[model samples]
Target: MVTIDQANQDFAQKVQSMDGGETLMLCFQCGTCTASCPSGRLTAYKTRKLIRKAQLGLEDEVLSSPDLWMCTTCYSCMERCPRGVEIVDIITLLRNLAVEKGVMSAPHKKVGEMLVKFGATVPLNSEYEDKREALGLARKPANTLGDEKALADVKKILKATGFEDLVGGN
Candidate 1:
């Protein structure tokens, strides 16, 4: 059986190599982040538990959890952490690890696909375009889909980072 000490040592070594994961060692498991997370209240997403799993080197558990994807990157947990553990940043790191392991699945991939194809996840229907015009914003050219340039840039970065496969290709 894997001992807690062994787990901690493994996790320490793994996370230490990550750029933004240095502060993970300081987490005291106070559960403040879990308590403050809006998604945790509404769903089964437990930020504290996820952190604990990561700390224990339960990489498979952390990588396979759908709860990791539910974080909206709201930064509420980061603000509430008493230990000053970069909660949101750690979550982002876990997500990147999961993507690297090819453990992340679809729906997430579909969202990326939509962003690459339409420049936004949601289509800019006539109503939203009209609303933008009504709000006195100069209407973009009708041919303009969305932030095509930005999306293209994002695709290039994702490909370089090996996220293209995580998002189910370009």
Candidate 2:
């Protein structure tokens, strides 16, 4: 039940002003994006409905929605859209906005924390290191995991992008 008073009115314009969100107002609600959404089949992610909510200025509802994070970004909806709407791009922008507002999901937050601490999403543990050694490979690959300077570089990049602040786990 979206009441008139709940509308921010400028939410749609803000979205439209975003780079990938230029096509925001072009949606005619044909439901094609929803029909073509793979995530919608397995989850409650209705791309069309979410776009409508954005158009209606339901900023809080749109940004805080778990469904907003459910997009696999496979571009299926964009491929099938009759209006050439950049649905996935808009979703990406929405996700960026959500993270900016500190509305990230727990699992995503954990991944961010891992990157901040380890410079990688999945740190190489002893078990995997042993397996790699047995296979005649280095315990850690030639990535941030294998190099302290590289890890420091990654942390620097994350900090520069404000990902550390958004993730919030030290």
Leading candidate by TM-score: 2
Off by over 4 Å in 1: 1-9, 141-164
Superposed Cα RMSD, model 2: 2.1
Per-candidate TM vs. native? 0.81, 0.86
lDDT of 2 by residue, 1-170 (tens): 77868989999999999999999999999999899888899988899999999999999999999989888889989999999999999999999998878788888889889999999999999999999999999998888999999999999999998889888857
TM-score of structure candidate 1: 0.81
Kindly give the number of clashing pairs for every candidate: 0, 0
Assess candidate 2 and give its TM-score to the true structure. Answer: 0.86
State which candidate has the highest lDDT: 2
Model 2 is weakest, by summed lDDT over 10 consecutive residues, at: 161-170
Q: Go through the candidates in order and give each one's C-alpha lDDT.
A: 0.77, 0.91
Off by over 4 Å in 2: 126-137
- lDDT per residue (tens digit) for residues 10-100 in model 1: 7655875788788887888888898898898899999988888788787777788899898989999898888888878888888888887
